[model samples]
Target: MQYLVLAVLVGCVALLLAVLALRFGWRLRWLLGWLKGNVLLALLAAAVMLGLAAWDLQNFTEIEPRAATVGTLSFNKVGNQQYEAVLTGPQGNETVRIAGDLWELEVEVLRWHGLPGALGLVDGYRLHRLLGRYLALEQQHDSSANGRELLPNLHSTPPWRDLWAWIDNIEAHRLLEADAFEVRFIPLTDGAQFSLELGPTGLTPVPLNPAATAAMKRFN
Candidate 1:
């Protein structure tokens, strides 16, 4: 929808420019000749802008500064310091058994700067992954520890590529300004439920039930 609005605005601006050039052509004949010669070029430029808008729509999502819930998670204890976590998000419901004292969720973020930022292209994000974590320093480094993945492996198909990766590479080389990878940690408790929120800066986990709140209080 944002892209559609931008395309409409660009078309209106192009039309206005043409109208003004024609209106002033009576006084300056060169302006009229230039407009005639550049008609094809103007059309090409408009087409390019529209193509960019469409590509952006597929690659990014416009996010607001305020926090918004993107997903929910609930856990059921399956073993000592292990749980069967149920997560509901953009990819639908997923269940994974993880072992640890807490769980970590990570997201990939892309922020536009300069003119694109001013033109209402706000921050965009994608669900990266979730992993179980341990509080003990030694357990964290233990290779055999059961710190399982909590999200499925979804691969991009043809025509749907990782544009965010390309943008991040450019930003790393000082060619552009972009933000990526925001992580949040949450304690895992039996029957605890949490809502994952995305804000301007990063991801936050909000307790949605008494079990979750109590767990957060103890964990903190």
Candidate 2:
């Protein structure tokens, strides 16, 4: 929706520029001739802008920033050096096998662009990285290493890099420590933010709110 609005806006601006150029006739003759000679370049530029606008509208989702939840972290110690971290909601039960003793949830900031962003219509964040830490393994490799920062040489996918470039936006990554037998997430505008801690008896949702469940849905 936002992208659709943006495409329309760009088109309108282009139309306005044409009108102005035409209205100024003699005053803008050189500009008009130049435009005619460089028609292909003009069209190419317009096409690129429209394509980006469409892509943005399709990829980006708008949500209530203050109430939005970004991502969740849940894990259970399965063995001496192994743990299972549940991703997203409980229904999926999608788990990742980790050889680490801890986990980190990283978030990337995303904000609206053009007119919508200027008017504050769209602004939020998105999940960039979610990684499990193997503290024991790291200690074995680097004796001086402390788990204050993320493991080095972390690389992102080409599509993700391209999308970031297309949007020309800067992403902020924040690390949150995850505890064993519990799930917690930060309150981000675009991703999942929920807290669920496993107790002695079993697992249960924290805060007991419908939004908690809905947050997982939005985050996914």
Candidate 3:
């Protein structure tokens, strides 16, 4: 949409300049030639800029989760100290592995707000980060869980990757904190109907309701 407006603006300005040059006669002949060349160069530059902008929009914008499910989490002890949580939702099942005694689960809700969101510009959530406890509170094993794993690679070849990182950097400052875990949209086939919220005391399981399961069918 921005690109469309820019192109229209540039075209109108170029047309106006062309009309002025033709009306001014031989005195502006050299200026007309220069303007033509410069306009072509400007158009090429604008094309590149528009392409980059489109890519950035596609990669950096966040849309509402297409499918949000609320599920019940069941924990089962496995091995000596390790544990496995089976998240059974209406759509499907997901397994979350917890390696430490002290662990935290972070669920983030990202939305495109203001003018950008109104324009229907959207982005998406990472499925693993939304449901999996990939990071531990402390480093205990050789394969330490780094929060950086959740972030997209800055060195990635995609031109839009930097834009994505920049947008995330902005959102990082506005993270939401909750006392009673607020509702979050889980992107899964058979996900939980309600939102997942984490606090200092850890997650408290919510019993599955047949009514909620029926309502969550709308997301599917």
Give lDDT per model, in order.
0.70, 0.45, 0.44
Q: Pick the TM-score winner.
A: 1
For residues 27-123, write the lDDT of model 1, one tens digit per residue.
Answer: 7778677888799789998897667545644544556679888789889999998898887876577777777787776666666666776777667
Per-residue accuracy of model 3 over 117-195 as CA lDDT, tens digit each = 5686553322222222222344443335454223322122253433344455563433321112223332222223334
Better of 1 and 3 by TM-score: 1
TM per prediction: 0.61, 0.41, 0.34
**lDDT ranking from best to worst?**
1, 2, 3
User: Residue 58 in model 2: shift from native, Å?
Assistant: 3.6
Total clashing pairs in model 1: 0
* Ten-residue region with minimum lDDT total, candidate 2: 173-182
Residue pairs with colliding backbones in model 1 are: none
RMSD of candidate 2 to the truth, in angstroms, is: 16.5
